[model samples]
Target: MNEPEEGAAPDEAATRDASAPGGLSRRGLLGLAIGGSVAGLAVGAGAGLAGGVALGRARAAEDAHSAYGFFGEHQAGITTPVQDHLHFASFDMMPRTDREDLISLLQDWSYAASRMAQGLEVSATGAVGGSAEAPPDDTGEALGLPASGLTLTFGFGPGLFENEEGDRYGIAAQRPAGLERLPAFLGDDLDPQASHGDLCIQACADDPQVAVHAIRNLSRIAFGRARLRWSQLGFGKTSRTTTTQATPRNLFGFKDGTANILADDAAALRDHVWVSTQDEPAWLAGGSYLVARKIAMLIETWDRVRLSEQDAIIGRDKGEGAPLSGGDEFTAPDFQGTAIDENSHMSLAHPEHNDGIRILRRGYNYVDGNNDLGRLDAGLFFLSYQRDPAQFVSLQRRLSTDRMNEYIRHVGSGIWAVPAGVKPGSYIGADLFA
Candidate 1:
């Protein structure tokens, strides 16, 4: 498989009744009160605006069904329930962007994300009602929609800390030891355009419109500060992060992430996923490193393979997704017999053979239309969160000789240090800047 060109245009909400007992929506109240404060400028105007913002936030916090908390020890998207849709975008800082500009952008992004997470618009002025000459704060597509469990995760790439010439943002010294460029692996036809970025944003939600809207507004916010390097739209989550979620299928038509690290597995998360304060730069505490691989599945080739051969390659029954050596879906695979090949995908990726190392997978399936040769351009966009970059590096190294390599090609790759979650009053990566 050949690496395609870098540029690709990639591609949600609940409805709340405005006429309910409350009469006005929480966001509507906020807009009116805040807008009133600006117009009045009389006694207690400051108090009115503050009270309105606080009240709006309180209402948002109470929305556990549709909103994931923005302020937490770790970011939401990593451990949160895998949403049905995804809009992942990587960006490169503009040529003369300074450290302060980066900080400002992060602050603006964090504030906007917080509001959006609560089913509110990016700004108080919203998509309309702002000055006629100014662009709308929000894109307006997600208007009147519920938050849809929206999550916005941010990460900093190795290039963000330092460039080839030298430290660009003067924060190279603060870079986490685990944040490094991934080594070229076997059978990797990596595309330069989609490979690396200075930063990335992963926006996910149950509603496809919500996911796309989040990224679109965020991109608008990043206008001059940064430009999109690459983006991907994904549907059909391939992994289950929470026990409540059922395992989803990938492009290979097999159940994927049957043995993934669950969000409730606290011990597993601490050991393999979340970065600890003791790991290195304390700023990354509670954060995790993300490894993204654009694995292009040769659908035409795989579809032609015999059924038995496909089963042997994946080591799982296509119908039940149970291991050949297993009894049921959740049953542990018994690698003792001839049931599973030594180089099968399951055997190589299993934690037992990988020194008990497992990563939290939040992958998705993508179909980007037909390729140049008329073959379906589709595959699994593999995303994994790990405590250290080395965890993924070591794991991928073992899979280099796996039998499934022939059916898929690694075309795009990226590694980013996902900083700790934002505090209510702080921006993402604020500790690093401090």
Candidate 2:
């Protein structure tokens, strides 16, 4: 984690008062200070100013309604109640960057992320208060908006420890044994441009604007130190981490994550989700491995298929989302049943077939506009967390014969070592350098 810099706010409490009545909220003031425009009010002079102040207070109030704590035992996005929107990004460290520069960048990023998660500006001075000649510290697009329960989770890719040129960061020796590139899968049509990165950030939120705003500001902070390799904007969460959340449907109109590991399942999380010190290079004790796959659904072809064929392919009832063998959404699949196809997605992906193994899935459906032929360029952006990446490898290899592969193409992929969460004064990844 990055050290708290000179201008960084020490804690969320030091940032701004969420209950204050009629002053410009920190975000509003920061936005106005930056280049954001205030609407011209029709009211008289004093009323106009009061109206502006009220607007700021209202914005703060909305933000306070759904804020997530930034500092915790583990990162928020992974186990935090699944958010409605996602902005996932991958970045490559600039050439010749060293350890100190990388540490400074992480520190700066942590500072900014902490403040933003609490609905505060990146810094106390913010955009307007700095030097006039210099560019504003914040981009200011999220000025009047609430934090929207935003969570920022960071990760280190394999390339971060040792690049093609060599171990440029010197910390390659500390790389966890589980941190390595994923092997090519059977039907992977992976795009190199979107495949790998030195670093990644998964920002999820209840509001789309808030999610995008967080990534935009973070990308700005990384300006010279790193450059964006690929980014994905996703909506309509395809999984439920908490039991309270109802299972969400993917773009295929089927309920996804029916058998996913719930956040409240402590035993499941410890056994399958979190990495232990015994399994790693000490710093990654409470960390997790993230496997991201940009799977593009062949919507046109899938739509043309008969409903029964589609149901057989997924091994679930389209309306009720139950296993073809019978019972409700949560019922275990009876793979032995003749009705359930042996090559179906449910049969192949079930824990019974993969050595009783399961990973925590937090995926989202994405539609990236149209393809050259005008069909929807969209599918499930699959994101899963596991204690060891080998678990995923094992499970995915078993899924090689899945019938659902016909309707999807693996277009982009990445795997990263998500470090354990930070303490009060520490920044993300701080343990690595320790």
Candidate 3:
């Protein structure tokens, strides 16, 4: 649910249907079915249209700070590919004041989100105010719990805020890593003086039903811990749309999810995340991470690329994110590997290509169907959370330039100032942004 420093994550490497035991385990279930299963995730199928209308007044008058929740590790276990019982869910939270009530409300939300993720539609609409009532048509359907193939996930947007920590968040931090492998961006620890942002939790379930519940439930926990406000948002598993394809199909059609970065576990952190090389935030010690990016793709321009040429430019198989230069999915490109046309693994095709630019990409793929223009439309809701977006932006300006630049375009963009973890009632970024 949470946007990565870059964008969306991949479905393949993502655990879609596996469950690990205890806190350190993978999400219960993960992965999304490519075929009919897509239909099963009727994301907008709910009375969302109706809920919008019904909850209008109540939502307008509801006490923004009166509701909240928080509960971590009450149950501990990591599940991956959470089956179809899973779906990505998140809240468009609004900052509020009252922390205690907000926490309790989140407790209810946690239970609600958790239960719903398991295929139990606790309420007609997961709305915050007057729309809380379950509609009549949703009776059987809303009440029905998803069985098999469910995966759930969630995210806390910038809107979420707490008292003690301000904007600072809480998450277990790991030490700095991969300095020797310095990405083209900073070459060294970029955030030599920054701290980890506040808490951000993620979960995946197999079944779409389960995914929704998992996200909502976890969201509740977040609310309980801090005085917060929220609203549900997001879609099912993300894939390419037609407008985004080489021929204008699927989100920017250049074969999606290929550039994603996957860190298998705590060990992979150093290689993927970033940390300060010198004395930094003592509390931030051992905590090294990146707020990749959120760069919107220009699908219309991206569709102009000829299919075969697309493959050659990225120097990897287009369908899968393998390097054309050589290597399997997730394998670091052999910068020295032979190129399709005597090119280097990380060399820029554009005249502006610069070896000095290197960025760790952890973005996701998205398809926001045809816009009002009726032009085939789609693009990445790209996000790459990095120690410094500057590094990524600099490198991307170069990468986005190569021959591939014509195919994709930078349409929407945003940057968030993230911080380190904090104790309950604590705010984030108190020392810095605050």
Candidate 4:
């Protein structure tokens, strides 16, 4: 029944089972199977290729239904396994709002985020349950969808504490000293509209729609208390936080984050990623600093270059992602060997050369359509969590002479002081307000 007619158009045959007279379309059949309305019926049989494709899709659907808890010792998205999609938004508090408004906004956001993380609606009176005469609490796009492993992580920017208008929140003194604007880099061509905010929320999930929905609902909840400043949508995560996952390639076609800090490495997280009581203003004790960089890759130019030069710039073989000097992808790089370029990306960013400094990376590749020049306005959305802003600044400075710098430009940048995880009864950032 799944096979096509003896002689139908190649496209139509693959898309529909035309041999079955007056039967349901191929899409209709698959929809019923995925929705579990037709459990007995086989979805993709007879055709080997089609069966494999259907099986792969079924696995993805199952993965999307998974959920993550919102309230924890630390935010889930930081060390949580990296999700495939990202909807990261920056926001600024309203000018006339006071301390109470900021506090209330965090409370409202926390409530909704906690519920949504469990695959529930923003409110009990969600999309359909709300009064017909009034607006629905939820937007309804994710009504039938699972939580998709959604995780919401919030942060406070430098402006959140004390902007040009002065300390409106009355907690300016609690701001971490390291939570300031990122300094200028060697090849910066930043866009003011896409950079900086008073507050930021990072929504990540396996499904793109779920990630977008999380951000959309949060923005609606903000209403008059805060307004969206800038946002970036990213797909195809460039890094993984777990050992089970394979190393994902970046837009540059190199296996990125091969030596990234894993979630299970508590020592590394303490030394490099998480904040400590000994370090600073005390309110942000269990928190971490987040650095977001919109690194625009010049793909057109990079693609035209020869493979060997490309490998040289990245400091790894294109095929196995192994160091040019030696062994496999996971092997420790031999910096002493002359085979690897001294200015290559690996050498400069490696902890060996940078006083054993490391940052937990959670980056993703993004494509924002195309620019007016008929060029792709796409690149890697580089995100890193560190113990201090200085850690990232130091590493980025060391990469000033990176050979890969010629093929990329840093366009958007921001840094935020991410507070510790939210306690069950208390709201996010309640420590600072206390």
> Each candidate's TM vs. the true structure?
0.86, 0.87, 0.47, 0.85
Name the candidate, 1 or 4, with the larger TM-score value.
1
- Using TM-score as the measure, what is the rank order of every candidate, best first? 2, 1, 4, 3
The RMSD (Cα, Å) of candidate 4 is: 13.5
Over 332-391, each residue of candidate 3 has an lDDT whose tens digit, in order, gives 555553555333223552222554333333234445467787655444434343443455
Question: Which ten-residue region of model 3 has the weakest summed lDDT?
Answer: 21-30
The 0-to-1 C-alpha lDDT of every candidate, in the order given, reads: 0.78, 0.79, 0.32, 0.78
Q: What stretches of model 2 exceed 4 Å from their correct place?
A: 1-65, 131-133
User: Measured by TM-score, how close is model 2 to the native structure?
Assistant: 0.87
lDDT of 1 by residue, 323-408 (tens): 99979889999999999999999999998998988899999999999999999999999899999888898889999989999999
Candidate 4 structure quality by residue, lDDT tens digits, 234-320: 999999899998999999888999999998899999999888989887778888999999999998989999999999998999889
What's the count of clashing pairs in each model shown?
2, 5, 165, 0
Residue 223, candidate 2: C-alpha displacement in angstroms: 1.7
- lDDT tens digits, residue span 1-434, model 2: 12222332223332332211222223333333344333321122122111212112134332354666666678879988899999999999999888877876786677667777766555543445345555555566676666687889999999999978798888899998878989999889999998889999999999898899888888777766788999999999999998899999988888899999998899999999999878868899898999999999999899899999989999999989999999999887787769899889988988888888999999999999999999999999999999999999998899899999988999999999999886755678889999
Pick by TM-score: 2 or 4, better one: 2
Name model 3 segments beyond 4 Å from true. Answer: 1-96, 117-142, 147-265, 270-304, 319-322, 326-364, 383-402, 411-434
Model 1, residue 72: what's the lDDT?
Answer: 70
Predicted model with the maximum TM-score: 2
